[model samples]
Target: MRELSVGEAARRAGVAVSALHFYERKGLIQSLRTSGNQRRYASDVLRRIAVIRVAQRVGIPLEAVRRAFSTLPDERTPSREEWAKMSAAWQDELEDRINQLMNLKEKLTECIGCGCLSLTACALANPGDALAADGGGPRRWTPG
Candidate 1:
């Protein structure tokens, strides 16, 4: 079983060495240590990195990626069925995010014409001063 050094893995994964370290710390990827304490990763890590990159590109958080990766067996790369199942689980969440972004775009377009940055006047955002009840911090624009 051949393994790649951290630098080689970073090059092949198209990520910085620090990013790989971060992923390791977050448990999204794993590596083995040599007798001299150098990090070496199995070639399967390239596939894992690719999956992580795709999930991140779609705005999935590292925590979510970690959770999804946890579903795979520790000793092997995810099989096609595992990948499909994970993707299916994320589909609804991604769709919800898309809808939220679309709604935000529409509101921003309306705000441009309305000029209602003033919370008191921005009925679209402030909406009957409901946020005032929440205290001093900025209110979240998106509902959970």
Candidate 2:
């Protein structure tokens, strides 16, 4: 079987050598050593690296990626079926996060109708638009 040198793998992977070393250290990817004790990788490594990059882009944690990889046989590049299963799992997580973000955005908008304290609608603090509540005018701070 043909193998790629570490440099070749990194170049094809579009990551730095240090990143490859880091991935190896984190068990996200693997490499074999030559007789002279140099790192080499199988062609499948490019696919694995692509998965890792996509996972990261979508905010999936490295630990999560490692766990997913561990579920695979020999931790090799996932087959198409395996990828579909994995992507479905990530899709659920992304949907949940997107919901949370949308909720936060709504809260932020509510809070800032006239500058409430971020996500907090503290009644004791500067609650939403005091002047707007009474009448359309400006409110002043006495500086306590």
Highest-scoring model, lDDT: 1
Q: Write the per-residue lDDT of candidate 1 for residues 1-144, one digit (tens) a residue.
A: 689999999998899999999999999899989999999898879978987887766667788788778888888766888878877766766676577567657776777878877766663566334333333344432222
RMSD of every prediction: 4.7, 11.3
Model 1 spans > 4 angstroms off:
57-59, 113-124, 127-144
Candidate 2 residue lDDT tens string, 14-132: 99999999999999888889999999888778877887887777666787788887777674556889878877876876685577557656755665665776444543244345313
> Weakest 10 consecutive residues, lDDT, candidate 2?
135-144
Clashing pairs in 1: none
Residue 22, model 1: lDDT of 94
85 Cα displacement, candidate 2 (Å) = 1.3
